[model samples]
Target: MTSPQLENHLPFLRKTGGAWELIVDNKPYLILGAELHNSSMSSARHMESVWGKLRAMNINTVLGNVTWEDIERDEGVFDFTELDRVLVAARSSGLRMILLWFGSFKNGSSSYVPGWVKTNTRRFPRAQIRDEHGSLTLSDSISIFHSECVMADIKAFTELQRHLANFDRQRTVLMVQVQNEVGLLGDSRDRSLQAKKQFNSAVPNDLVRFLSSQFNNLQEDAKEKLGRFQDTLSLCHPSDQRSWEDWFGSSVYTDELFMAYHYATYVESIAAAGKRAYDIPLFTNAWLPKPAVGGGLGNLIAAGGALPGSYPSGGPISNVIDIWHWLAPSLDFVAPDIYDADYTATCDTYKRGGRPLFIPEQRRDAHGARRLWEAIGSHLALGACPFGVDSLEPESFAYTAQYKLLGSLETLILRSRQDSKRTFGFYFDEFEGQQADKGPPIGVSFKEFDLLISRAFVFGRPSPGCGMIIEIHVGRYLIIGDGFKVEFKSRSATSTFTGILRAEEKSVQNTVTGALRTERVLNGDETRSGKWVNMPSENPDYGDGFIPLLTPAGTRIVEAQVYSIDE
Candidate 1:
């Protein structure tokens, strides 16, 4: 059967179908994936071994990078070579990829720009910031115009998209990140003399016209679209050219508007060019650290400037959030790179756009990993990824083959809806954390299991902890964080079902080493002795990290009182 047009399928993420509960398809298929970086660079030689490990983990999609510096090597000279190698490796490995454009900005750095651009300030200027030294710092690449951001750059990015589409026609390379962690820093706005000149001038007309049609109440529309309007129609009682505060409401308006507009233009250009190459979904990811401290003033600048009302706001409520949604017709969706505290709240922030929610990056916590699954089920997230896939230490609890499977199954996670088992979560805060987020708490989903999240005693906390007493009553709970303990009861999934008498184990391993092994632990009195080590011997893959697989369709696991691993 022919695939749906890339345009048509983009909205599928927000729509729900089927019986048990909120669904994205006739069945649920939430994403569960891990990210591997610093492990795999923009090189072919590195891909093979790295991917073999990911495959072992059952990880499907990869949030890979096709850096701008690598692509734009010299003035007018573009290289698709590095990008080519990565794509070939990913295709061969059956790994879908999210290509992050390490362009003009990456984690607030001009470091990614080619040597030529960095050296020649004359051709491609910088965002002029007044450093403490009284001298100005050429910061904020967003405001800097370039000799390199040519049709050539756009065309190169476009061609690269087509090249991947040739091999990933089956939809393996699910999305392409327009740029890596695009943000502004230091000053709330750019210090570019050129940017300043433009800001002082009248707002653009095209932008104004666009906002008029999308929003009601000119004032409401003006607030959402703020800062950058290109010749807006003078409807609201003749145009007096609204004042600075009247125009955008916040101090940000201009800078955010510029960043959003710039990003939109790039994404739109790439998307348009790529469609000429092949047809598949394309998405962008944001680096959302703390809306403030983590990403710098850039978050305010970019998000504030956005005409968010332009995109497909799916559920709950809506408002303009970022420039990503408005600028590009070719771009399918915008996502977030979630890190730090407040998983549910952060996800909710993106949900305001009401577009499909996907966490392109996340922490590699065991408890967090499980929460990711819940996130996919609850928030309708397309997938999730953890940072630094390869360098994890041997003792790090985050390092495990079990997670690879979580990553692999991510693409099809939306499929495992009510048919999948729903679990529980725990925490300990009086009227905060889980305690305050009453009701289903917006993270995990199990159809009827509108998960009751509250601040209980943290999992590994001791006896005197009031929140520690009542553990999740479910037999299964996915773990992500480190240093947590749970002592309690769960309906014996095995004991309740007849002919389910078996203790299963499987070891997930590295394809090359074959020597790698996964070991399950014994907890509580379940081990049957002073022996904390002699639990039942089950080798799912003989200690490999993949799921219930000593055999196929494996559901065989002997029930135990508790599970704890001293990683």
Candidate 2:
């Protein structure tokens, strides 16, 4: 038999990449994504229009939710005809899918469950909370204890995965987000008799083991205590507090701890099922805060019950939910579903995990648009996906995307820029913005930085003849613009400083826009001058520049790169 044909695959987003950069065809691939509902248009023809919009925007991944309400409206019965049409349309449009198996919980609600389960008060149970009238209400509509954990939901979802494996396995649809935002949303950890019994049982060996390894030589009281506190490891805090009270203070600690545990269990289980059927990489997306706390947004109160409420004027837990590092060890990668502004801080928080980050969902704001570029060259982000790529207005879509993300990603597409490229990592440098001398030269020693906004203003006003001074280490960092100069010392070649070997200058530009030229100064007069670079490049067209003269204590950059300066 002939070998099976594979379409453009996003193998990087799958299970094997783990915490590192996602590699596709032996290279790390970045995914610019947007999440879409199962049927925004409720028909295949509409999907074609949506896909065209996504392609024009250059979005690479689509997070599509496959709902239980549509698949299994009746128990022991299933329907996938509509979902099949959506997947086929998505594949034809050349966009990959991070399929959300909307099996049980979506933002802590059972609204999507089958009618039989939702209406029945007996077989499928509900979470209980003390209502204002001294009666109990459902903790959340979707519960593993009540609605979702059923074999009914699992079988149908598993079947959905099987269908995708058979049909679109080798196409633009590559990975699956087993579930959407899996977490416990209650006034407290479930207190119902059924939930309490399961909660009281000796904590699972796996978690106990992981916890034991994390805090070795600590008291057993600590282990037992964390279990009692349940949600945020309250055992580490004051002894007098109740688990629910943990909700009121430093909400991140509790929200994140609870989310990480709950989400991990759900993802691992769902991933196991999907892997058994199709062995693809699976992930989950966290609905994050605009100025969120590190753990998770703590505002989801559904039908007067607790759920993941990080959206819509959420309460206390905003700041604490932003900590990506605290939850790093648990999931494949934690994605921030961002909405609102200040894109820089949001992306920065995610990267703190030290794992290669993927912006699975982002705000519709223009600042968020520019940030995609900033993230690519500045932080070495693996992928960036805008939210709702399918629904974006037609007018400025291409203009925003083609330059916003596609421009920077060009380095990874070509055979030459592939291996030579390096992530800029953390830095202390400066540059010019959008005005005359508006762009300025910036420099940073391992200890300090050189910032010269513009020499243009000191003598005259900036005008039509423009210039730029940017300092960066990614996607061909060019310190000066077309008619400028720049110079800096080479790091190290063979475990020692490679002294200044005369600076050479070369202006390189995209084959298309020779007007947008770049000048590189590998080495120059600034080397070993006590300060790496004191005077900015005197070259008129090159703009400003930066030179780093690392101190003796700093580890020499392991390789000696050739030095140059040319026009």
Candidate 3:
């Protein structure tokens, strides 16, 4: 089949060695994005009011939902009125978009399906899950086993893509998420008659062959989870067949694996159909597992249930991520909708085996804002989108300052990402008097210098700070953000000491060119007389004994170079 022709430039992903870049207009583009509330994009007037706020906050891209129910209220009939309005408004605001297709399964519920599909339960069966009692009850989740359900979703999504290609010839819509947090809810696996019948039947020969071939390449954790399946595959003769329970044992993990296979296959079909229609980059997002207390998996917090039904079963979490990757070929990547999870660990897990990392959703708070530096700088992530951006005013949003700094330095940051080792990002969280000694100081070595970064020194208490250090050239580095300090030492065996040669604060002189113009030369107090370079937070606590009541936050970008000396 031939792909649809895109008239103007289309956004695509490119891998440069270890790092991946999002290319827009044939240039490396950093997506400093903000996701609107789920229901906000339905009204064009409401969207018009918030576009200015999003622009003021320095958001280059916006992530919003485009539900199937809204677009296809009647069977075979599709409406693009709201979608067109959103695309036009985003273009007017000079912003790009990633539309989340809230179809088939939305957060483990089929509530977003069209009324016709929802009303006809007999034609399109719902997943059955165990209620509080032992008896089974129908859940709101649509059954993946049914052909009618898959076909309906594929039709709606294909039409959406066709319409996008026609209306958005400018390529304002950069990417599309096939479904929203798709998984089996309220049960580890669907308990309906159709699901049970399939579960008891022989495991699909395609999946069995895939598992047998890719066993060695799968992640260690994945191997351990599917060890039983491997054994079953090895023992079973060509004439013999094994069911899901027979292969993986009757555990919750097995149930999760079964659901993941179906979900991935279903999403793959929809994504493949959409690609045939328009061929824009397509992906899906997962509701990640919350932090586990220890290896034993009991003291997990937030919705941190390790069992299949505890969280959304069959979502593309780390445990089942490899399965989705093997099955969902059409999906460009899988993203995490991070809220209360451990940010660094989650990002690291998602980018396993050279996968592209793009955090589509995260908490919209100061804590979340501080973590973006690590995600983008250290992980080489394409972008980070904090959720519910439209609800907050530009002045109140925690990411406003950080986004502005990143927006201005987009070019420089993209350049630095190529050499992953030379660049390091860090964040110093607020010291709440008790948990002061949590994270250890970060130490890095480059050339003959040892760089030590820790929380900026404060008299009374330390406030939150976040930033990245990019070594533009040998011994020369560009540092951006607030609330951190860099201390340098000599790594040379001969040199006695290493000291900063020059540290200058920089500002963007030309926004279009991303040219950095030095605003002030730092030496005496700012550098503490070559001791360290401090980019203090917006409000630093200098203590009551000091003359100036409170030192305002020093959220400035700086450049520094160092030289070693032997006495």
Per-model CA lDDT versus the true structure:
0.47, 0.46, 0.84
Q: Each model's TM-score? A: 0.63, 0.63, 0.94
Scored against the true structure, residue 74 in model 3 reaches a CA lDDT of: 93
Q: In model 2, which regions exceed 4 Å deviation? A: 1-28, 37-42, 130-135, 146-150, 200-202, 216-263, 289-331, 340-356, 402-408, 411-420, 425-567
Backbone clash tally (model 1): 61
Q: What TM-score does candidate 3 get on C-alpha atoms?
A: 0.94
Worst 10 residues of 2 by lDDT: 551-560
Q: After superposition, how far is residue 526 of candidate 3 from its true place, in Å?
A: 1.4
Per-residue alpha-carbon lDDT of candidate 2 for residues 280-378, written as tens digits (9 for 90 to 100): 556656554333333242444422222333331112122323222233233355555555534566666555535455666665545355455456545
Write down the worst ten-residue block by lDDT for model 3.
293-302
Error of 2 at 261 (Å): 3.3
Give the per-residue lDDT digits (tens) of candidate 1, residues 443-466: 334321222332222212211101
351-383: candidate 3 lDDT, tens digit per residue: 988889999998799989999999887888888
Q: In model 2, how large is the Cα lDDT of residue 116?
A: 82
**What TM-score should be assigned to candidate 1?**
0.63
Off by over 4 Å in 3: 1-8, 233-240, 291-304, 418-421, 544-555
